[model samples]
Target: MRHGVQLLLVFLVLVLAVPASVSASSEGGHGGGDSKKKEKSEKKEKGDKKEAGKAENGVITIGPLVVNILSNKGYRFLRLEMIVECADNEAAERLVKADAKEELILMLSNKVADNLLANSGKMILRKELIDLFSKYTGPDKVKNLYFAEFVFQ
Candidate 1:
């Protein structure tokens, strides 16, 4: 009687494990067919579109901004991708019209690497940039400033 119960338990385990293993194999083994690969790619594309929409809700992206750094190396270049956040889309529009990029480029171009390379220096620079952006977009218009890419050499 105990052996019969053990056999029943093993039978139930097999019943549950088969479907799980089959589904796992189907989801992970895209090499099985073109259709699986196509389905996975489609899901990825949908996710990317949703993320892009969310990420730029009240943000303006500006970049490949190249400025001459006031370094001892006879002015090295700093390439940046700046992302600015605002109260809303209207503020973002105002930021663009107020020549925000021009002001930022001018401000950074006048700075030495020592004023920007350290963590504390970067924090100070972020605050300064936010203030400069606010000045350009008008009081209370700009919310935050981010460096998507900061490369100096």
Candidate 2:
């Protein structure tokens, strides 16, 4: 009876060991295919992201702007460089060729003078300036505004 029990235990061990070894060998053989597939999918996804990011946002760059701000009868100043993002190719082209670009800058400068440089403007947030530009310039014309260079004095 004891010998029979020992033989049963050995049979169970063999059964478990055989399947585990077979599965490991199979996985090792096919592992290269799985890795290659994963790599291809990752590359495709990265390409898609690059295309989407480029197509949706077109960059428009302009010269730097330097302006003075007056707060509480003290002299405060801001020198800023800016870039505008346009929604599409046409808007980007218009932004490049449009005569109203200077006018838009003038309007933004006025907004800064009225809101930020005057009175208690030292506590103003940078978002306020971005909002001012966005408010004065229609959303159709400008997708987003970025301050590439900003200095406060």
For model 1, state the Cα shift of residue 21 in Å. Answer: 40
lDDT at 147 for candidate 1? 85
TM-score of 1: 0.60
Model 2 C-alpha lDDT per residue in residues 56-112, reported as the tens digit of each score:
355655545666555555655667666667666555545433455565455445544
Error of 2 at 2 (Å): 99
- List, residue by residue over 1-153, the lDDT tens digit for candidate 1: 999999999999999999866875776663455567688899999876533222356787767578998987788988888788988776666555536667878888898987788988888988998888787667887788888998987
Screening candidate 2 with a backbone cut-off below 3 angstroms (N, C-alpha, C), the clashing residue pairs are none
Stretches off by above 4 angstroms in model 1 are 1-55
In model 2, which range of ten residues has the least summed lDDT? 49-58
Worst 10 residues of 1 by lDDT: 48-57
Which one is best on lDDT?
Answer: 1
Each prediction's number of clashing residue pairs: 0, 0
